[model samples]
Target: MNNIDGLDSWDGDRDQSVVLSEELRSRLAPPLKIGNFSVHSRVLQAPLSGVTDLVFRRLVRRYAPDSMTYTEMVQASGVHHARSLKKIMDVDPAERPVSIQLFDCRPDFLAEAAEMAVAQEADTIDINMGCPVNKITKNGGGSSLLRDPETAEAIVKTVVDAVHVPVTVKTRIGWDENEITILDFAQRMQDAGAAMITIHARTRSQGYKGAAQWEWIRKVKQQLTIPVIANGDITSIASAVACLEATEADGVMCSRATLGNPFLVGEIDYFLKTGKLKPKPTIAERLICAKEHLQSLYDYKGKRGIYQARKHMTWYAKGFPGSSELRGKLCRVDSVEEGHALIDSALASLA
Candidate 1:
């Protein structure tokens, strides 16, 4: 029980896999200190464009309290030019140790935006260089920065100098196979004063396809002295273990995997700390969580939050049979009452 420090309130039957080997326990339990903030858990929430809002982050936090979460990647230009983009900075003051990840090629805008993120009480300012979307890459941001390391370093340097909080970079292996630049790009960012780095382990051309080349992350980690977090293809306990063993990264960052199963980040964190695997939740629990997730979004975004909750519901609806049907019904429910009805029907059927 002393090993599992924070589960006194957990009602579910505890899994005994909590004892970690001294080697892995030592390796896995490394805390990341980025500038002024120290992350108690190394499992980080990657900045998904539309997915990692304040509500979604809270859901993940319930399970993984110390796991650091990120905001949806904001556009530096948008933050400077549009109040709409600035809205992304709005987060609960309790969501400390959260990073506001931003993207843009403009050094000046990045500096100003980093300052704004500091105002929002962000734990750190992260520059996103791994996004492969054409919109981000075409404008000289995201993985496109991989193709131009000089600009990437300048962006990091400007932001680091502008804010008291640590500056971090999340990036891919390279622009593509032909332009794999992670090793060099990571070095430049660190030299420019980045406190730590996260590598998603795929090239720009790979997009979200194929296995994340975690080997590239190993290469980057070998070259960097600061803490390096390994990402990509880390959806389950097995993959998380494999990636860490392969790359020797300081910690593992979870991205798309936390979609519906917010408990997964916590599950993995628990496994790392105690070396135990918890059983996956039952359908009843899943539906209850889905309803809670929806209500939280509605509380945060009102009616418009329904649209956002739809995707999260769909993700949670997976791993069991007939999930597609549940997803279909969820998509049509526009109001909280309607949404609760849909969950009720789904839970009944599952039961």
Candidate 2:
């Protein structure tokens, strides 16, 4: 395996250095306090469905030890009826600063799920009010909560009362451009006892398209006292610092940017803490990480994990020679050995 440490020289054109302003550095210097829990690093790993399982998070934790990470959003109703949901909520005790993100319209079910999350030793309970999937929204959960602030508030208040650990909310700016209600909605969540709020900065209708309207996050942060984390378009250290400066956000969370590169969170965290840029991983190193990810998923979930690894493998096979061809081959891989062979072949070619 080609470890990141083995790579000393990188293409300077590919890695741009970001200068952190004194004001921004001083502002983010202190620990991010979520209720009573303190996370040393301001950068967080967003809870991505099917992508942020224990196998993936362990890889992320290897790079960003003190940063907070979240479980993929679990359906509160699923937890209420099925024991199988436990697999998604699985948290390693070593991953101390992790949160279990749960989504539902029902306050009781969310509260029950929060309790289960605490038992799993989650550092905090994050309510997913920002997911924009139609299935989630039509079900009266996710970003739909942005439209129904009453239930959203009730969910937060109920869960805060139900759990001993901090309860945070991750939400979008609004349902759509015409209904940008984040200011009022964010206030309601804070009033309802939310310790922190992470703003995705896009309307639910956008569903991740368009430039994230970061200005809305700036507005919400002004009206709230709790730590505000800026999400959406936070891909690189440059973008993270830019967002924090633009929004005056307490932190920035990495979402889609971390798809194939788990090193992103730590890269931003290191830059924020020390005003130094970490070297970007070479393509060969990335392929090696992808190979390890494929094997780890297989070790954890057997054949089903390989099916999931297909997408992840494709995400890794990019930005290099023959990557397009490699991705096409990777997405159809059926076994760990097959995936390893493809990545190994890519690595050998890079060498």
Q: Please give, for residues 1-351, the per-residue lDDT of candidate 1 as tens digits.
A: 112111222223324323455777796665777765788886787777778889888888888889899999888898788744476678788876799999999999999988988888888889998888897788999888988888988898888889999999999898788988888888998899999999988888888877788888899889998889998867766667667788989889887666676787888888888777767777678778989988988888888888888877776675456767777888777888888887787777777
* Clashes per model (N, Cα, C within 3 A): 3, 0
Q: Which stretches of model 2 miss by more than 4 angstroms?
A: 1-15, 83-85
Please provide, for model 2 over 111-144, each residue's C-alpha lDDT reduced to its tens digit, 9 standing for 90 to 100.
Answer: 9999989999999999999988899999999999
Model 2: number of backbone collisions: 0
lDDT of every predicted structure (CA atoms): 0.81, 0.89
Error of 1 at 284 (Å): 1.4
RMSD values, in order shown: 5.8, 4.3
**TM-score per candidate, in order?**
0.92, 0.95
Candidate 1: regions farther than 4 A off:
1-20, 83-85
